[model samples]
Target: MLNCHDATFLLSQRLERDLSVTERANLRLHVTICRGCTNFERQLPTLGKAARAFASHDPGAEDSSS
Candidate 1:
């Protein structure tokens, strides 16, 4: 029964690993009935993977080349 805004907010926090078990359960319940939220949830793992990849890359490894 969570609104889109709240679901998205919780999802963002969940991505940051800041959500508690209760929050996660609530989000799960919300996504189950909401296609938009379900789609949003599906994107999280990909986003998380991209974030981890970005974080793992060495900043100094970038080279300025023509």
Candidate 2:
């Protein structure tokens, strides 16, 4: 039974496939009942798209891997 706050926190990480089964299940349960979290889920993809666009536009940005 994850709360809205927890759901938002987990949403992106889960989308990245970084969450454990238990955490994913909890987030799913929260999004099932919380409209706000559900909306947040809907908007998550938009954010990812924006981030991808930004990175694509900044090819010369310093690599963080070093």
Candidate 3:
């Protein structure tokens, strides 16, 4: 039984990283019952894509992976 706060945090993490089995299970359960969190989960990819596009167009942004 995850609360909205915990669920939302995990949702963000899920976008950027792989969730463990436990985390995936908990997130699935929470999103199944919570409409707001479900909507948030659905929107994550679009937001991530927008961020990447924005960064790609910025001339001063440093690539930190190297």
Candidate 4:
């Protein structure tokens, strides 16, 4: 059984590195039972995409606020 902190940490870390078999199993179990964690997992991809877009945005490329 994993606490929310541990489960969330695992979720974030999995994006950066490969989780062990046991880690994946534990995280899956935790997210399956935890609604908040489930939502967080589902939102991870969208958040990642948004972050990449923001990072690559050009502040001076165009003036849209007129």
Measured by lDDT, the strongest candidate is 4
Candidate 4 residue-wise lDDT, 1-66, digit = tens: 999999989999999999999999999999999999999889989999999999999987777675
Candidate with top TM-score is 4
> Taking the tens digit of each residue's C-alpha lDDT, what string does model 3 give over 1-66?
899999999999876799999999998999999999999888888988998898789554566555
TM-scores of all predicted structures: 0.59, 0.70, 0.71, 0.79
Ranking by lDDT: 4, 3, 2, 1
Q: What is the lDDT of every predicted structure here? A: 0.84, 0.85, 0.89, 0.94
| Weakest lDDT window of 10 consecutive positions for candidate 1 | 57-66
Cα miss at 48, model 2 (Å)?
Answer: 0.6
Cα RMSD (angstroms) for every candidate in the order listed: 3.1, 6.6, 6.7, 2.3
lDDT of 4 at 26: 94
Alpha-carbon shift of residue 50 in model 4 (angstroms): 0.3
Residue pairs in steric clash, candidate 1?
none
Global CA lDDT of candidate 1, please? 0.84
- Cα RMSD of predicted structure 2: 6.6
lDDT of 2 by residue, 1-66 (tens): 777777898997777678888997888888898999899899999999998898788555676556
